[model samples]
Target: MAFLWDCYDAWQRALAAEFFGREHAGQAVVFHIDDDVAQTIREKHQLPESLAQAVKPHIDLGQRSHAFGTILARAQALESEAQPPRSLPLLAVSVLAASRMSRDAEIQAINYFTPLKRLLYGEGADDNDRKRDALDQSFGQVVELWQQLDRWLRSNKGAFGVSTITPDKFSNRARIGYPLSQALARLADRQKLTQFFSDAEITPGKTYSSAYLLRMLDAWTNHGRKRFSRRFEAALAEREPAFASLIVREAHGWDGKVLDSGGSGHLLRLRLAFNHKRARLFWVAPIATGISGGTLTSGGTEIGFESDLSPYYEGIERLPLTPASIAMPLRVHGRAAAGDPLVAKYSPQEIILFREDPHLGCWVSQDSVEAHEEHLLLVSPEQQAEVRQVLQVATSGFVAVPPPLFAAVLPNGWRLYRNVCFEDPAALSRVSRRHTETAARLRPNPIGRPKLVGGLPVLKELGSHHYLQGGAPDLLLPAAGDGSRRVSVSLGGRTPRTDFRATGYPIPLPQDMLGPGRHEISADDAVLSLTIHERVVDDGLPLGTGTFGSMAEEIDNPAITPLVVLARRNATETAFVNCDGTVWDAITPNVPQWLHRRRVLENAPLYYEIRLEPHDRGWLIERTARHVMAIPGSPTWPKEDAILSAEARTDWAKLILDVTAPPKHVLWPVYVKIARKILNDHSR
Candidate 1:
């Protein structure tokens, strides 16, 4: 029973394919009627009594005329083939008998039409065998019709309207050639067939079955009714000649403002002019990066521009704006005056007004500032504030400033300040402080020397001195030394020391002076301070060989001692050393040429001699040293009398001695007194 029903369904589809062409005929034949038409038909007419009784099955109003025409044509064709001499009421009888027979009686009724059956089925033997053969023969005919339709569809590939298929003379073999041909031509001319079944959606080279082909046709027909061609042509008419030519053949749809064109996977958004006289279509996909001035090709024509519009396309997608609600300024200045009014307008709620520069005139927001070609403006202060608030939200937490209108009224220098200010005052303050600190850190140290007392180091308050945190202090000394300078020293009080050396000579100083002492030594001339100390224990060993007597016995020993002596000069220090087998040479007196070099006085007395004690092994030295010196004339004595009167010179000498003396040396106070005396003498 199911097999019979399946055969019947196939039979109907085959008939539909034969009549409507394979393109329009779907899997099943269905007749559609408008609701209003159906209602009107029911109310206007009633079926005749005889016809109603003869046709007991429900007759589809929509398919009635097509079915009648098909039956009539089939009967006439059969009669013409038979060429019957007596036109037996055979055609009428066959129709009536077939309609009256029930499903169970269908085989017998077919057998009754023996002559017709024989004509259709060739020849048969027994009655039962003949009936079965006749049914197979009938199904075969339907199958043959299906094959014919498929072949016809394939042969007339040009009817589908693709660019590859050229048009040829068409034969209406399937009776549906006209409508199919017309649909294909319309689809080809409008260039919508390719868009409907894009490469991404359907595979190329694969034969679309009859059912699938029909579906595509249905979609194409429905899309046509949308009038995409008319809309596209209208949009093209509004575009510039260059841009319109590039996409003249492409289908497009206008969504009031933007004219959208291209196929399924790719699309171009053409912003239309308000007057519908011009348009600008931008390339959307594969957004060009770092694109400056270039030309984009569409169809065959190239549309050239000096700036990139990919950002504009992306901005629209990211932040869509309502076309009708965009704010337009009553007046525009600078480059903005020449821009499209519609394009210039933007939603204040989406963008803030940034200051206009010579390069970027009237930009919309911070993001828009990068692409300076776009001109945007805010009409009023209220709108500017609203835009600022909106920009704040859009930029996460940044404060956006609207361009000020009162720039001309502001103070001269203040006009150069940024229109936008950072919201975090503390952050701005910290940045300022950081810059100041960095500048100070990079400044070079002052060029001055340390003031010394009695060949001992003393920290004196100099006017505005920069106290360096790390490294040894600088020392200053007069260039010419007569070696006659004598200054008593308090050795125990914070006296610096040098590390022990094997070859060192230990000064046999009294142990009583080793303790802290308070004493003053006067010097007429400047004296240098030399501090000796043990090498830092962690510095390992000194470089040179040890004493000859000790080196042999302690060649493998890890406990060798080293000593270093630091000599102080003006803003600089030199190191000297003495060890068991090695002694550092005397300090070289080659001063920088920039300094005033002076020669030592001939036969000058030996001012000081430093000595160290030896160890029990005769290699190491005891941690003791002695200092000897002689008094010398003041180094500043020659310049003093010339700069000051005789009486003032005496006073200056006394002041210098007091300042350079021991424990509480008051240099600043004594220097001030001498300066006053010099000024008074000069006045006289």
Candidate 2:
């Protein structure tokens, strides 16, 4: 033993120097426990056998580091003693050493057993029948060994002797042993594993109390928690990370709040667990009372920005009437089979209240208590004073309201009791897919009149942030009867865009510039001397004649303007070409006459003249005569000139032609057709 101690002491010194950057000559650098232990020894009379055996091999009681070194050395010696020359005497010695070095012995036992478990539960071994039997036997041996240790400890410790009693223990002598007995039972339950340092025989002096017992109990609790954690990991092996995380989370009882994404409930509560060898499970709570799985119900008060119940909003005190929120308790009353009345309600103690901000609109009592009452207590208070205080608080400050209004405002109020279940992963996957599909169907597409002769539909595209497709190629436009006139189309409701293209025709180049802001179209006709620039005047007032704001349909203020208009000016000799390639000379008086002819060709008949008086409706033109002809199909342009001397006054046929150029701008619909034909025909 002496040799072993020296070896361990030397190894510890070396490790400390190498690991802690400390030299042997440093001032008081080594660890020491005597300052505390010596005082404890003086107060307790004789040193505990545990302390003596644990420290006997060390020369320096002043250094905790040296004492621990002795303990490690003795452990090594015990392991060696277990060899071929092992004897019952050596076993007794080992037992004594272990009782003194309780903490170290526990650690060594775990290390020794782990490898054995791995070998016996060999990986990929095909014999399932044998594996099952081996596991049962191994588990049994562990339990038996654990029991033996418990018994040995109980016999040695003299039971955590101390002088003071704690609040947790106020009972007399017969009940003095209750806590110890209860701890022992818990340790032996197999379902639970605990580390305790107490014995039935140990007792403090006659005046000793429960405070000391409480301190020991706290130590044992923490020790058990750590011990169980390691054992659990060893038993489960590689399958432990996720399950361990889950256990720690559950042990701490953390919770999360979920808001509406469109389902039956607006709020959700979740609790999850995973044991790799077992199945993963979760608990869910919807917000609907009597909803089999809801965590809240309609009887509760409403919660929101205006509610005075929650302190969530920054300027909540500024609102006129603050909103209130609640989670009302559910009560069920019915007749039983035995003709007895059945009345029950979920107890407040059984529920968990989770609200970060409690003052305004954040949370409310689901019970039939006052609105201002705090519903934080989950279980009923056993102390009569506490119960009375709760009742008094509920009655004076908070008051309950009608049930229907409660339901209407808080539709997702329900309690998620223990039995609530989670969604199946497979089913949830399908639901998500369906949600995406529905949103797609509601998406808008832009379709228009065929631009080019054989144009195909362009796949409508939208931007990442766009809510709807802007240009659908499938939408049809009002026809230009006989395919001779121009047509116009509008996309005002479902989709919106100021930029557009004719599936195949070219007018507005994909990269061509449009003016700043949100105006759609403008156009001009030189011969007609008409130029219209579509303008929108949108002022922030509620009376703007544009997309969003309006006090009335017809806004007459400075902010309102006509949506579409045609601008024209009488210009000098601007010419237009006939279908037959004719040119004509025109001056001021001829302006009306020339317009008359052009309008006929374009299928736009003028109902009135520019003169202030009502204008004549019917007046077609004779291009050959260079004069007005009031008929639909006048004698085919008199192809040959009349006798020069006889009909010279009206015999003016100089191929009466007008030049035509592609319009700089026209209505999108009208221009798109001309554009399509132009792009398609080689001789345009």
Candidate 3:
């Protein structure tokens, strides 16, 4: 895409150079000025005499001064006539004058003229009595002058040669005027001001009405501050500690019977505290085994929580625990909805606290599973006993492993090896060997000249298949063992027609007799071959039949004149024929066979049609045509010719010739009349 764009740019540059000379072509100049300069220019139009006096001292510095003088002269001429001067020249001259001033003077100018500038660009004065008085006192004339200048600038912007200035260039100049931080601060301030007041009321002001003040306060309380706090809370909730605390508080009263327990205790309750370091919500369950040495001990299962629940905690200090709230599924070790026994072992009781994150479900722990050190919470011994008693009662009828029970059941003579790691050193090597052998078995057989298949005397590769339009190719059939048997063929379940006498070596199969369906051949009781033939289906309109009149009717009521004119003009080149049996002369000697057949047999079958349609810009010429077949003979052609009178042919030819080189006056009114007709038809 980049290469294409480069080629296009090069082509454009070459064209420009060829037409306008290389020195002037491809030379684009862009000017950049600060917003302050734009404001100064606008304000100067309100008080041109003062602006001209201020810049007179530095006016003779360069050719720019002469340009400024010319701008002033134009301004005087427009003022005498009570019209505004062109904005582009005034803007350019103002920038030149501002650049010549010292930094201190520029700042002073901004401060001194701000009040008068505000009278023109500031909030509406009519809305407030005090503002209205201020506007009328000293800035009334300035306001009027500024409005006049702005109106003229907007109306004649193209005449001033400033139409090419785009918003992007203005934004770039704004960016270059101030440091990033200062610009951002200004933007933020503007957003706040706009939030509190309508755009018409946005301006620098030392004082605001009590009504406006109250509105600003309300906006800050309900929108600005609340929005900031929510963002801050969301940011805090991303950390592990804060998130863990949120989960503990939210699930304080969650308790339910687990589903699909697989002999493990299926009931559980969430503990109030959270393991902040591990970012886990702890739970309690009854031990699966009896106590040993007066202490209850059982390993716990550990699973990681999936899905980020931080967004739910934002703004709300704590979530409400209810059955209908947070009943989501959990991902056991990041596996959800898998049938593996390890992952599907237990369905933990749902934690109903807040709206569930669709992707993260509840987690459950079963008895006898060792808890990893990193996942274990430092709970007291008494708490563990209490949890065990609660779970034991919950699982009284469930299966339980006795104390000191073996981890795995073994055969009679077998022994267990503790703390031993089993490793397969040649695992990858065995896999590589297996893959190599499998690939060799799947490899394709080498190609050789076609050979005959078994006792049937047919090639193995020449099996039953489908052939398209042109029919199947010739096939050589081998002779029978006795060297006297004949081959017979039938098509589409029909009686056998053609028969070939068999000799010994080979014979060409009859392909012409087979078309579009199953074909069978047999020497005796056994079927020697079968083939299916088919042609590509065409779903388009038939060739040289769809006409302009039909197509125009197809469109919702189209105009008829432009279409008629165009039809008359291009009649000789198109496939359509007049109703009077006068056909268009073929432009080329090699006319398509289908078209020729359509003209002769169908009595001038119409192929191309034209219509005049109402479009957004005006009238449009719409042309429609059917596909043309280029084959030699038309399948539908008849044996006779349809002729028209010589008088009719002469009249059509003259009409066609007149339209071929129609004058603009003749063509335009036809288009207008067509457009009017289309509008009138649609209105009706």
* Candidate numbers, best TM-score first, in rank order: 2, 1, 3
Q: TM-score of predicted model 3?
A: 0.15
Which of the predicted structures, 1 or 2, would earn the higher TM-score when compared with the native?
2
Tally clashes: model 2.
62
Best candidate according to TM-score: 2
Per lDDT, the best of the predicted structures is 3
Q: Is candidate 2 or candidate 3 better by lDDT?
A: 3
lDDT string for model 3 (291-336, tens) is: 1101111224333221111211111112222222112332222122
Tens digit per residue, CA lDDT, model 2, 1-684? 455344333333332232123122211111111222223432444323332232234323234223223333344445321121111111222222222222222334333223222333334656544433443333332233223323332333322111111111212222212111111111111112111211111121222123322322333333222233332333234322222222222222212212121212222222111111232111212222111221122235321211111112222122122111123333333222233332223222223332212222233222111111133222222332332233232223322233343333322432221111111223322333434322111111111122211112110111011011121112211111111223233322222333332111223212122222122222111001111111322322111112433456475653432222111123323222222223233322222243233231232221212211112111122222122222211122222212122232121222121212222232222323332333344245
Better of 1 and 3 by lDDT: 3
Candidate 2 error regions (>4 Å): 1-124, 135-398, 411-684
lDDT accuracy of residue 652 in candidate 2:
24
Distance from true location, Cα of 297 in model 2, Å: 24
lDDT of each: 0.26, 0.24, 0.28
